[model samples]
Target: MIIAIVGATGTGKSDLSVSLARRWGERGLRCEVVNADAMQLYRGMTIGTAKLSIAQRQGVPHHLVDVLDVVDEASVARFQADARAAIDGIIERGAVPMLVGGSGLYLAAVLTDFRFPGTDPELRAHWEAELQRLGPADLHAVLADRDPAAAAAIGPHNGRRIVRALEVGDLTGEPFSAGLAARETPWRPYRQFSLELDRPRLVARLDERVRGMWRDGLLDEVRALLPLGLERGVTASRAIGYAQAIAQLRGELDESEAIAQTQALTRRYARRQVSWFRRDPSIEAMDAAADDLAAQVDRRVAAELVDTMGG
Candidate 1:
């Protein structure tokens, strides 16, 4: 059986995955961990993304983490394809595949079997040229006219998403939201689980984590990447911590101001993630902050897997 562990950042999803993998291993069940976080795909982005260490993995096999160059544009379609292949391989080997991370859109695309409007190289080129000339807000306005629903769903400040929506509409003659809504869910192949926490406690944890990130030299991480000449819209540059740090480095703000701004943005993102997962009835949510999380998971997973094993 396949299982998914999902939650907002700082919710201890990875810790739970590691604990479960070790428990299942003791039971002589084969399992592998697959990453679903978008930023974790980039190499040299370890600390900023909170990527798993070799020791932290505890010899459990992991797939699809740190597999991309910082400059590479890793699309959701690419992520879906890679994850599908990994899932198939794990099942073929009689192992359980556990997908774990906080990237809501990426997780939704894979679990729902959402198909993008086919890409047109020529059309994509045209849109890229137009984006360069017109800038993001103008392009976003155009998309708002063509696909108001998509425009509403995507933040206007998120230029990459705005550009993508316009490009998809140009290629498919349909809105991006329409394509997403039309797709059927494919998660029947897996049993999904979600990690949740008390709202006040979660917010407090998020604040503390952001402060810890700053103390751990998040600015230095961004400074190291600055020499790479990374562009503004690349996925890594837009990461919650990286974006604010870059602004500070560029003299747009002081370090204290940057930290405050980054923390605020992260808090907002976490709220959205919580809302998204809450809407999905399929997720079996568990209190991640509880002292007995492993016991709770064990009870639930045992019941579900009993049926899978036909016992």
Candidate 2:
């Protein structure tokens, strides 16, 4: 069985995953992490995504991190394949696969047999050209008319996602959300947990985390990746911190302005993440601030695994 560690940003999901793996390892139960964050797939995007360093991983193996260049567009379908393969291998070795991330769609893509509609080169090219000509907001408006729910889930500034949503709607002759109906079957049985933090505390954590990202050389990291064509990369360039940092580099935003924008955007994105995950009734939302959180979560996972794995 697979386990998903999901929630909003700044909720300590990564640390908890490592802790759980370490605890389970003592019982001779091997566990490895599978990356579900879209941006974390890109190499050299360390500081911005708050990825765990080699030593910080605490000897737990992680898959799919840093597997792509900044110029590569991440395909959720591709990630589903890669992550499931990693999980299958871990299971074959009698190890647990921990699927961890805050990206709602990415997490779902891995946990479920979510089928994305096929893309059309001619149709996709037309949408891309229209997106370029009309700009994100206008294109978003067009999407709203055709598939309002999809448009609502995607941000206006996310032109690539908007284009894909429209492309899917056109091909299926149905709203993009149609493919995402309640699933009777997933890849396998899994116990999913979502860590939650109250908004006030979450805001403070986000503020501190944003400052930490800056102090830890987020700007410098972005600068280093620019030579790798991050600026020209459509998908990578729009990453939360990278986009703001790029604006700072181009003199569109000062250092302070960039940091402020990053914090605000991160908080907003966290809300969206939580909202998305909340819609999945299968996920047990854990209160991260609770004193018994770690114990509670570990016990549930241990019991369920024993039962499901026939221990």
Candidate 3:
């Protein structure tokens, strides 16, 4: 059975995954992790992304992390294929595959029968030009008028997603939400667990985490990636903290302003993640702050695995 550990950022998803894998290993059940977070997929984006180092992983094999250069645009369709292939290989070798991250869309694409609509080059180019000319806010306003639900979901700051939503509407003559609305049967048998905390607590944690990123030298990390084409990266360049760091590096925003902006954006992103995952009825929610959370999850997962085997 595939195990999914999903939730908002700073909810200890990574720590939980490592703990679960280590526990399962002790019990003779091998578990390997496959990352679903988009920013974590890019190489050299460690500090801002909260990506675990080799020592922190404790010998657990991880897949799909640091697999792409900063300059490469991350596509959900491509990730879906790559992640599924990794899971298939893990299952073939008699190990449990764990999908772990805050990215709701990437997790859904891998766990469900989500299909991508074809894109037209001309239409994509048109939206890109519009994004450049009108900027994210204006382009987002156009999307809000075309599809209010999509606009609400994508948000005004995310020009990439806004453009895609508009392109999808014009290309398919359907709201972008239509694609996300279909909750078809999953492609594989799986159990999902979501870690959650109260909004006040989560917001505090998120703000502190963003501050910690900068304290841990996020600026230096961005500097390292700049030579690797970070600014040229359509997707990577716009990641919450990375963008702010880049702005600070370019002297556009002062250090305090950049840090504050990143904190605000991170909190906003966490809210959107909560909203997205709450829509999935298949996930079982757990309190992230519970003292025995890992033990509780391990017990539940053990019971589910036995049931799946018997059935």
Best by lDDT: 3
* lDDT (10s digit) by residue, model 1, range 153-259: 56456677777888788777778877556334665466667888888888898888888888988888777777765443378888888888888888998988988
Per-residue lDDT over 119-205 for candidate 3, one digit per residue giving the tens place of the 0 to 100 score: 989999999999999999999999999999888777788888888888889999999878676545787988899999999999999
Q: Any runs in candidate 2 off by more than 4 Å, and if so which?
A: 182-184
Better model by TM-score: candidate 1 vs candidate 3: 3
RMSD of each: 2.7, 1.4, 1.6
Clash number for each model: 0, 0, 0
lDDT, each prediction: 0.79, 0.87, 0.91
Instruction: Flag clash pairs in model 3.
Output: none
Q: Can you give the TM-score per candidate against the true fold?
A: 0.88, 0.96, 0.95
Ranking by lDDT: 3, 2, 1
Ranking by TM-score: 2, 3, 1
CA lDDT, candidate 1, residue 119: 70
Q: Which pairs of residues collide in candidate 2?
A: none
lDDT tens readout by residue for model 2, 83-167: 9899999888888899999988888877886887788988899999999899999999999988877776676777888889989
